[model samples]
Target: MLLETHVLQDTDPDLPALLADGFEVVGESWGAEFVIDGGAESTASLERLRGFVETARAAGLEIRELDARDAAAIESLDAESWVDVPTTPATVHVPVSALDVRDWATRGRRAFGALDGDRLVGLCVGAAGDNDFVVVAPDQRGRGIGGAVVAAWMLGAIEAGERSFSAGGALQNARSLAMIRAVGFRVTERWLSLQRP
Candidate 1:
């Protein structure tokens, strides 16, 4: 799946090479960033995300950083969530393994989840860098869980000295786009996907 696994910049030298190899544009994904210290606009964006977190808490969703114990549940949730999703832009980031989840939990405080009782109902996490990938369970969506987990993760990221945050997804993914925008990120980079037809 290397054909679709990457998002290439508009000026990437590999664009010509891929085209020469019979690859054609199949889809596009956009990259967005939030400048933590950008002043009033930044404050307003952060307020929105913080508000979502408050809403989630009022609804009794517990947002916390993931540890090793959350690995299995998060992995299971990701695998199951993908089963019903119909190939959205974020699908490229799916099928997260337990090992990877553990790595994120054990390394930087990058992975976080929203819990409903003992069940992990939402997740937002990334590697050692910015918290990029996020997913909320199908049944638990629309109640601000996605935004809450992301907000929780970003709060931690900022505490850990992450001055700016980045996120990306398919160009057509309105759900993910809406969530990111609710925070403070702006579309800063866009890249296309090309694959063999």
Candidate 2:
């Protein structure tokens, strides 16, 4: 049997007592995920990310709000994008199927995508409940395309009257964690994963 756990960024200030136990560390246990506060007021970080996305758009990357139920658009979510995100080898990457996206729509969620001409360079979904998931093309990593897609999603959610939002990601995924914070999300909790003998 296999077990997983997570330690959030907030707990980095002081290692929790549980972490000192005989849990074998396992190179950062994996369990819970980071929760983001999307309803956060506009801050310098949010403004900066928005500016970055706009600049990228000016350079020809088009950002558009997507209907999660669109079969063709859901089919466009690239499999390669998921593997491209820099994450610990321990991170589990799941495939997104069109049926999964249809489920997103059933939950009243909206999706967004970034296009470079006719190519789908990035994609994300915003739940009416304020949860979000974002992905960017392999060739487009570190270029703020993911951030752009997420920012666009947030804006659309705001228009739809969503006053609060949150998302989860592995703690080992620093790049993504940075992007989430760059958009004004603060870490709110820490979880520790422990395996039983």
Candidate 3:
């Protein structure tokens, strides 16, 4: 298994060293955050990670993962409803173009949407994993949409033989934190970063 962590802009410079030390870069996301995965059982590797995290914190950074679900409704919601909302500066928005829904549908990952009298009010995007659903959506704040979508997503994940789910959010987003907690997710770990120019 790979130990995953999120790194910020100031921490980007340290990524090469971490990679050289055996960490694999999994994904580079928006907001200058990068996800790195590594083996957790090696003591020398772990110590190197400790130093990296401590340094990242000293420069003001954090890392974490979310409770993820794999469900049909998640994908449905995303396709049917999530497209209506405009991405704001305060929110983590994934443009619809970023996803290839036709491909996802064929892979057994279901998409879901929230309807308000035929108008799509919200959407949830999710993919099926071995043990969880990787879900993302725009209807997470004050509405009950987040919980509903997640419940639906979890149902799919469970049926698919996934034991659990995971998701992620930036510490700076209070709304996201509240929504994630409301759906029975707790912080599994903290990640720090050091963004550099």
Candidate 4:
């Protein structure tokens, strides 16, 4: 069962002893969202996102909008990014095949990527301006490329009159979680996949 974590927490009227008797949590995913709610991001938030893009530039990565053509180059990198994730049901990822990448690369008004010369080292994209995911190459993760890619995407998305953004990551993936939250995504859902022995 995919149960909201809060449903089993102290905030819930039902105690864990009453609700968790037979279910063992096998994995979890944090769902976050940042919506304009008929408005726009505050000025400070815009500055922070812009700063991430600049920081990525200082690290020698070129951040720019992506198109359908760049998909093949980064398909392998996208697949590789899922390697460290646990195979449990909740965290299972469908690697973005080259075709899948091509399909969504040009969607959502525009998507963005961080490139090291001719190589795509990180990408942030989704259909219709939703925050599907971001993946940075293993060697490039700590330098904020992932965050920059997403920030750049958000900048474009906001300018395009898009308002709603949503993203999710494994609860255990601190780096992924922090990157999204740093851009103002708030955790709205915490889903725990449970199994019966």
Best by lDDT: 1
List clash counts for every candidate, in order. 0, 7, 31, 0
CA shift of 138, model 1, Å: 1.1
Tell me how far the alpha carbon of residue 74 in candidate 4 is from the true structure, in angstroms, after superposition.
2.0
Off by over 4 Å in 2: 2-21, 27-50, 68-78, 84-93
lDDT per residue, candidate 3, 1-197, as tens digits? 53455464424567677666665543332221111233343334334334433443343332121122323333455454434433222234453332445456666655444334433333434566322122334543355544444444544454566544566545555554555565545555444432221
Please state the error at residue 107 of candidate 1 in Å.
4.0
- Of candidate 2, the 10-residue stretch with the lowest lDDT total is 27-36
Error of 3 at 177 (Å): 1.5
Full ranking by TM-score: 4, 1, 2, 3
Score each candidate by Cα lDDT: 0.77, 0.64, 0.42, 0.76
Q: After superposition, how far is residue 174 of candidate 3 from its true place, in Å?
A: 1.4
Off by over 4 Å in 3: 1-94, 129-141
What is the model-wide C-alpha lDDT for candidate 2?
Answer: 0.64
RMSD in Å for all candidates: 3.3, 4.8, 15.2, 3.9
Q: In candidate 1, which residue pairs clash? A: none
* Model 4: residues with Cα > 4 Å off, grouped in runs: 1-21, 37-41, 105-110
Q: Give per-residue CA lDDT, model 1, range 54-164, as digits (tens).
A: 889899988888877888998888886665443433336647888877676456547788999999999888754466578888888788888898888887776677777
Candidate 2: how large is its RMSD?
Answer: 4.8
Greater-TM-score candidate between 1 and 4: 4
From the highest lDDT down, the ranking of the candidates is 1, 4, 2, 3
Candidate 4 lDDT, tens digit per residue, 145-182? 98899999988888877777788767888888888888
